[model samples]
Structure formats: structure tokens, C-alpha cells
Target: MSEAFCLELYKDKVVVSYYAEKFHGRKTANGERFNMYDMTCAHKTLPFNTIIRVTNYANGKSVDVRVNDRGPFVAGREVDLSKGAAVKLDMIKTGTAKVKIHIVKMGANTKQSAVSAAKAQKIPITPSKGTAAKSQSAKKLVLKSGQLYDIQLGSFSDENNAREYAKKISRAKFKNVALQKSGGNTRVSVIKVDGKDVPSVVKQLEAKGFGNAFVKERKK
Candidate 1:
């Protein structure tokens, strides 16, 4: 894979819809002996030694896993967790849970590159000085007496493309469209519309060929 595929942060958290039970004793893609009891995961592209923290958004249970192998190459499937990891996250109870993956650290060589990339991006550790204005606008928090929801556009490497997509959607009569950047390479476009229209926007986006478009509450 190209270096662009090298991810510093979890691109997105996908709820686990399934797990591998039969592949218990097989060797992992990294040639490490696999044990279903170990808190390890299989990711298609993450460097073999990257460490990712998986938090179950449902219950807030979390476990750190070593990315020691690869598989689950199926489309739309993000990462495959070992039985132990799933158990720790209490995901087996629901058979699935929304997970947030954060790469706190990576392998030795990849670590240097990751650090350099982070320094170059200089991602905001704290809210930036200008964010006060945007925060105020968002928190001005008007209720349309209808609905409020958030839509995430696919992550992208090009900021301009992300901005353009946000602008295009903003012009589509949307009430709000915002862009958030993380680690320089990942830009996400979010669109919020009245709550009553959440399903309509989801259907429209799906019909318009946007993948992974889901409705989330616009406010906490």
C-alpha cells in the first residue's frame, strides 16, 4: 500500500457486525501465532505493530490491541477483533458495538514517520483561537422545531475536495455543513439538517450514492 494509506488516527470507528470464531489457532498474517484469547486484531492496512485503543461507544469499555495481522478484507468491514478483545469491550453481549480506534503509537520505523507527520500537521491540541467563533455559531443552537442530525462525508486527503464537497452540500439548501480535519490527511465533512428530516437526508444521500451516510444527533 502507498504511504498515503498509512494512517495516524483511526480513520473511523465502525460497529462490529461480526467476528471470526473458527479461525482460532491459525497463524496471523504477520506470521505470529494466533490465539483467540489474546487481545489482538486484524486490520488490512495498519502497520503490523501499531497499537490501537478500541473503546466500545455503547458501554465505554475499552481495550488496547496490537495490530499483529491482517484480514477481514471484506468491503465495509473495518477491523476484526480477537475473542478476548471483544469480550473485554463487552461487545459479545450485543454481538456488536461502536468502536473508536486511536493509534497512540506505532512500530519503530513507522513511529518516526508518524511523529514527523504529526509535527508537520501541528494538529490543534486545544481548540484554536478562531474556533471560538465557530463554536459560538454552533452553540447558538437553534432548534428548527423539526429535527437535528449530523452526516459524515467520507474522509479524504485533499482539503480542497473536502471543502468543495461541504460547499456543494451546503448549497444544496442544507442548513449547515462543516469540515473537521485531523492529522492533516483526514478531513471529514459533516452536514446537519432539521431532525424531522434526518431520514430524508439519509435516504437522499444513499440514493445520491454516498456511502456510510448515517444519522447522528446534532447535539449532545
Candidate 2:
């Protein structure tokens, strides 16, 4: 049997649909001047200046967006991503895409400054290459005991591809291979059981030629 699974979990995952249009040069609820080109988002409840990982289930794109505004009260829409974030998630043409937003950390200030000012304050607003792709692999991942973990290999535009990849993971000794669909994309993942660690699953994924595989909180 594998060891106790570990991962940082704040139990936060919000299904969101980004902005319907542009909102540049507006003052955010946090008193920060909004820049549509920045990697920021507007959340209704999360404290301002909180950093989050927004994964677009449509195209499998993920980006770190800071929460500096409040909105998306258009019923069913959770938060609104900036123009830059929408671009990163390939949501420009779609306008809104189904997304999973994970709370990463809080910002330095209760109400974070604008992206430009935040950068000037020496805060790291932009993520590195690895940090931006495949679920922020550049950032440190902490593993904790007793929580469930999943090795997500890929999100494809086709459900067949996702099923095929799940088959591969199953052949590699991983169990509970599953396919999840949302926002026009299908994802392949291996649900962990028997106390497996996230890194071990990641290694298995790498051995199976999925070096870009990333860990996500297993849905209960």
C-alpha cells in the first residue's frame, strides 16, 4: 500500500465563469485601480489581495490571479477574471469558461494594490513559466496526511482522448482512472487510494511519459 497522501488543502474550489466583457481602468472594490491586462480577478467573498489559481476546464489552461475586486453577481457566475487572465485561459472567444478556482494565499495588504503598484512594492505578481503552466509546478507543493490526491494528466478537447489517457494510467498500476468533463474539455485523472503520496503519483505519471502531470485535490 502507498503511504499517507499529503497536500495543502484549504478546501476551496469555486466553479466560476469569467467576465462577460472588458472592465479596464475601473476602481476595484478593494480601492485598487483595475488593469484589464493584469492577472487579477474579482471575487465576491474571498478577501482582497488573495492569490488564487484559476484553471480553465475548457482549454486546460491555468493562471495565478490575484483577487482585488468584487463582482460577478450575474447569477451562477462566481468570479471575474481580468482580460489578461481570460486570454491566458483562452476564454477571449468564449467569453466565459467553466473554471476551478483554488485559493493559494493571501496578499500582503488587506486590499492589494494595483498590479503595477504591487510589482513596484516588490511583490511577485507574475508567475514563472512552470508556475503558469500545468498548475504552477514552479511553486512549492506541500503534502499532508489523510487527504485524498489525484494525478491529473491532461485536459483534452475530446472525451476520447481523456478516456485513452485514463486507460494508460490504469495500465501503469494506477486505479480508479476517471474522466471528467467541464466547459468543453475532458480531463483524465487517477484517483489515489491506499494512502498514496502525491509525489509518487506524479513520478508514476512522469514514467508514463506525462512529465507535465499535476496534482489536484481529489474530489470526494
**Winner by TM-score:** 1
Report the lDDT of model 1 for residue 196.
49
lDDT of each prediction vs. the true structure? 0.56, 0.58
**Per-residue lDDT of candidate 2, residues 126-162 (tens digit):** 2333222124323443444566766555565545545
Runs in model 1 with CA error above 4 Å? 1-9, 17-20, 112-220
Q: What is the C-alpha RMSD of each candidate to the true structure, in Å?
A: 13.7, 16.5
lDDT for predicted candidate 1 compared with the true structure: 0.56
Score every model by TM-score.
Answer: 0.46, 0.43
Q: What shift in Å separates residue 145 of candidate 1 from its native position after superposition?
A: 50
| Candidate 1 residue lDDT tens string, 50-130 | 777777888877787887765443435567888888889887767667776666577553544544432322111122332
Model 2 TM-score (2 dp):
0.43
